[model samples]
Target: MTTDLVVNILRHMLEQAMLISAPVLIAAALISFLLSLAQTLTSLQEQTFTTVPRLLLVGTLILIGLPWFARRMVEYTVHMFTDLHRYLG
Candidate 1:
């Protein structure tokens, strides 16, 4: 494969990863921030307090959206396989 083709594949992979992960990451960030704010207000600085809920929320979101994420990943994988000959040097 050409350097340009490799770069394009890398870029597309990164874009797909970001697209698949953005929702979970954003949810985690928001949950962490809100938990921190609550901890600040109540003086509860337990690590588990902040961590568990974030994990649960993000996990739940990923579970709920698993199908969509899988579909996107499968599409990318299928596209790559279909273009395998083009990528072969």
Candidate 2:
């Protein structure tokens, strides 16, 4: 494959990764920030207090978003495979 083709493929992959991950990552960040704020306000320094909810929230987000994420990934994989000969040359 040409250098340009490789770069394009890499850029597309990164874009797809970001698209797939953005929702859950954003949720995690917001949850973490809110938890941190709550902890600071309450003087509660327990790691589990912050961690457990974040984990649960992120996990729930992942579960809720899994179908869309899987569909996008599958679509990308299918496209890649279908177009493999173009790259392989």
Candidate 3:
């Protein structure tokens, strides 16, 4: 493959990675923020207070979104494979 094609493929790979990861990352960030706020209000500085809920919520989100995540990954894989000839010269 040419330089431009290599770069384009890498860019697409990264974009797909970010798109796939965005939801879990966002959910974790939002939950951590909210939990931190609550902890600050209550002065409860316990680690588990933040850790458990974040894990639970993130896990739940992953479970609920598993199918969508799989579909996205499958789509990306299929797209890359379908376009494989272009890269193969």
Give the true-structure RMSD of model 3: 0.7
lDDT, candidates in the order shown: 0.94, 0.94, 0.94
Could you say which candidate leads in TM-score? 3
Q: RMSD of each candidate?
A: 1.1, 0.9, 0.7
Model 2 agreement with the true structure over 1-89: per-residue lDDT tens digits: 89999999999999999999999889889989999999999999999998999989988989889999999999999999999999998
**Superposition error at 76 for model 3 (Å):** 0.8
In candidate 1, what are the lDDT values of residues 1-89, reduced to their tens digit?
A: 78899999999999999999999999898998899999999998799999899989988998999999999999999999999989985
Give every collision pair in model 2: none
Residue-level error in angstroms, candidate 2, position 22: 0.9
Per-candidate TM-scores read: 0.93, 0.94, 0.96
Candidate 2, residue 63: the lDDT equals: 89
TM-score of 3: 0.96
Q: Where's the lowest-lDDT run of ten residues in candidate 1?
A: 50-59
Give the alpha carbon lDDT tens digit for every residue of 2-61 in model 3: 999999999998998898889999999999999999999999999999999999999999
lDDT for 16 (candidate 2):
99
* Candidate structures ordered by TM-score, highest first: 3, 2, 1
Off by over 4 Å in 1: none
Q: Runs in model 2 with CA error above 4 Å?
A: none
For model 2 the TM-score comes to: 0.94
